[model samples]
Each structure stands twice: as C-alpha cells, then as structure tokens.
Target: MFQNSSFFQNFSTLGKEDTPKSQWIVEDTIANWWRPNFDPPRTLGKEDTPKSQWIVEDTIANWWRPNFDPPRYPYIPAHVTKPKEQTKLFLVQLPDKAYFAVPKNFKLVAAPLFELFDNSNGYGPLIASLPQNLSRFNFLYNPP
Candidate 1:
C-alpha cells in the first residue's frame, strides 16, 4: 500500500548485491506534510521536530517508519505548533430558521461542492451534508 519511490532514492540499486541496505533510506513522505512534535529544555516547551527514521529511540507518532511490533498510527494531527486558543476557529452551520421551520421552498446544499469529504481513499466521497438552504447566499464556485 506504501509508495516505495518515497522510501528510496536509489531504488534501482536496492535489489543489487553491492548496494548496502542502509542506503535505501530516502526522504520520508509524511515529513513533507506535517512537522512532528519534539521539545527540548531549549525553547517554548513545544517545537516541531524531525522524526528519526527509527522510532524505537524517539517518541514520534509514526505509522510505517518504525518497524515496531504492535503497529501504531500517527496521532491524527497533533497541532504541535498551533494550539486551540491560538487558532482562529469558526463554526459554520445551517441557518437557525431551518431547524425551527423547514421551508418548502428550501434548497439542498451538497457538502462535496464545498470540498467537505473524507479523502482517506478508503471509501467514495462521504460527508455529503444535505443542509437546508434558503438559496439566499450565492457563491462563486469553480467546479472540479
């Protein structure tokens, strides 16, 4: 299921007899995305640190790297850099009038149009929220 191209730089030489297995290491794909949480006696008590290839030594939330026994999934996004209070959080939902009185003239808004769907590739597009819309708020949409 994993992409080996991200795991090895010299992928062609890996199966050869002369190439040492240790050199098979390449830049981690996960590292390209989120920075991991690592802190020291040095700065701010929280810092995003690079995870070691071998998780047996460090406490990094890794899924495929460690080669650990009893597998572990990386904590689904721990915001090491951004805390909840420091974040500009907002809540968007259906209009209050919709719950109180369902309008016969109400239109249905699809969540997929807003790019709200589970992208795990495990299943088809999910999170298709059928929110009741008054069709009052028009949006500029560039459909995919």
Candidate 2:
C-alpha cells in the first residue's frame, strides 16, 4: 500500500560490514542510554552526602576548584539529620478509631490498593477486612 513512499525508497547505509556474511549491523556511533553499569550514588545518610560526590572525588582527584579552594557546598551537609517522630502518631490514630466504630459481624476485605507486601502476607487480610471508607483513608493520607 506504500506506493513510492520515501521510507521504502530510502536506502541509506545504516549498518557497517562487521563480517562478510552479516547483513545486519549497527552504524550509529552514538552511545545508547541504557546503563547497566551505572549505579547512582546513595544520597541517604546521616549527613545526606550524595554518592556522586565520592565517585567524582575518587575519579578526578587532581581536578582543582576554580580558585584552587574547596567548593562552597560540601559533598555532604554538615547537619546530622534524623527521621521525624510525627509519622508514628499518624499511623497509630487510624487503627484506634477503626477498632471502636467497626462491627463484629462486618468482615474486612483486603483490596489491592491497601496491599503493600509482595508475599501476600502481613497487613493484606487485616486491611481487606476493614470497611470501604477505612480502606480509602489509607490512600488519602499517603504522601504524594
């Protein structure tokens, strides 16, 4: 159906002759985006030092800063960061309310939205047995 189409007529040499018998070859010299060896440096730590900072320093030790002085922003922050305590308070309050309001006969049905574990264990059944409104609250309060 593609009569006189440029795609069919164009016979540009896309591949190189790697072997005499090999017809299919890749001609593009550009590097592919796929990075199997690329491991981004871990940014999470007590000081929040980016992994790249260590990698760059180790790789290019001789490269001096513009004025032969240390950079203004250190590879890691100076402060010792700690996790916030408010998260525990938010988690505990939900179950307490659900315990008093839910009836004994009412069964909690675990939905996919509430299920976090891949093993099909843990909070799946407990969450499934909860009321529909209660199940939805988990989604609503989840951080963006």
Candidate 3:
C-alpha cells in the first residue's frame, strides 16, 4: 500500500550502499567502549599497551570430576565406617520459636518434654518442647 508514497521513496536506499567512512570512527577490535584506552589512546597516537608488550598466557587445565582419572581431590573409600556412638538428634520447634534437638526414639510426653527440662536457655546446649497440639506454624532460617 505504501509503494507509491513519496515518504518511502526518499529512504528507499538507506542500507543499500557501503558505509560512509571517517578517520575519527574507531574500529571495535582496536578499542573497547568501556575502557580508559577507548578514546584514541589519550593523544599518544600509539596505544598505551603495544602489541609487543602483551603477554601470551597458556593457562594449565585444572578441571577434575569427583570420580575421574586425573586425581586432584581425595578418593572415596570402598567401605564406609560407622560412628561409635548410637546417638541421633531429632529437630523440634518450641512455643517461643526456639529449636530443640530431641534424640531419636524420644518420648514426646509432657513432664520430660516440658516440665522436667528447665525453661531457661542456660542449662545445656540442647533445647526442647515441640509446641502442644502443633498446627500451621512457619519457623525456618533463610538468609536475607
């Protein structure tokens, strides 16, 4: 529909010709736009760092998988050994948003779970009591 329009005719050859050149326009390979060396190398004519001054670095490949041929990390032993102690902690939440590491096969009853244990947070490193009749309550640690 816009074929006969005079507005389209004036701009018809926009990208058809070769780019107009100028000595001031810097090539991307020679100069990065973000660097201090971007603007014609600060009136020196030659670049700040010459081609002969540049170092050719051949970095060593240090990539190794967990169970691979090139052994950098320690190998996993065939047979795994068990710990001497038979203690396992059960994580529980208290009424006042404090965590209690309860032992496995622990009796979750009243006196020992709440009454027997001291309410103060100084008796021992371990804390107690999963709140009575626990409903929907969110208490999780997330980094800000």
Candidate 4:
C-alpha cells in the first residue's frame, strides 16, 4: 500500500467543485500529460532493473514496507495510528473564475499562491522543497 499525503493531494481536487474539470479531464487526459522523461508509461530496462520489478517497488521495499534490517517507517501501533479529526475545506467557486475555501473558523481572504518549479520531478520532491520564501510571510507572524 503506497501511502503519501503529498502524492495524493494533487488528484484529490479533481472531482471537487473548485477544480477546473475541463483542464484536468481533457480528451485523452492521460496522453496530454504523458511523455518520455516526463510521464513514461513503463520502466526503461529489465537488464538495468535491480531489487524489484518496478522502480517504485524498490522504494516500497526500502521505505514503506516494514520489517527490514534498517527498518524504514515501521508500522505505528493502532493507538498511535488513529486518524485525527480535521476540519474540511469546502471549495467555493466565484463567478470571476477564482477559487477559495475556508476550513472551520479562520477567514482566508487572499487568493492562493501557486509556485511552479521548473525542476519538480513530482509533488513528493516539490513539497519536500517547499516554502522557498519566508520573507513574504514575515508580516503575518513576527517574533517578539
């Protein structure tokens, strides 16, 4: 079971009200985004392959799967693994084509800022290197 928050967050918004379906669900949507060195349909070579059948199988074997020598991300006890109750954001679309959502109490007045990385391999890598700028947020939370 592949479990990663950032990995699934992208596709999570697809059927939501605020998401632009036309852009995401274009005719032959998979082909629109698929290309060599971008979204290749298969692994490069069987001769070059090692550890597992697919490249991701290696990742799961090393990181996600439990009971290895190094023990990467061991399964948390059920008591600790219980899901926390979280406020859900309701997507509200404006007539002017702006998207906004508010979770429980706080008001989100500003429009979302989307930062596109030219070198992003995927959301996993992109989110890992996020918040490129802290200066912009200094006004919001300043140390005394």
Cα TM-score per model: 0.13, 0.12, 0.14, 0.16
- The TM-score between candidate 4 and the true structure equals 0.16
What are the per-residue Cα lDDT tens digits for candidate 1 across 1-144?
112243331111011111112342223322232123211122354565323332212211112212323322233235333221111111123222322221233322323433423332321211111111212344555555
* Model 1 error, position 117 (Å): 4.6
Residue-wise C-alpha lDDT for candidate 4, range 1-144, written one tens digit per residue: 012243343311111121211243322332232222122234466555221111111111111212222322323334533322211122221132322222233232221224423323433332322234222333334355
Sorting all predicted structures by TM-score, with the top scorer first, yields: 4, 3, 1, 2
**Which lDDT values do the candidates have, in the order given?**
0.24, 0.24, 0.25, 0.26
Better of 2 and 4 by TM-score: 4
lDDT leader: 4
For model 3, the superposed segments whose C-alpha errors exceed 4 Å read 1-83, 92-108, 112-114, 118-144
Each model's total of backbone clashes: 0, 6, 0, 0
Instruction: Please give the range of 10 consecutive residues that has the lowest summed lDDT in model 1.
Output: 10-19
Worst 10 residues of 3 by lDDT: 10-19
TM-score of candidate 3 on Cα atoms, chains taken together: 0.14
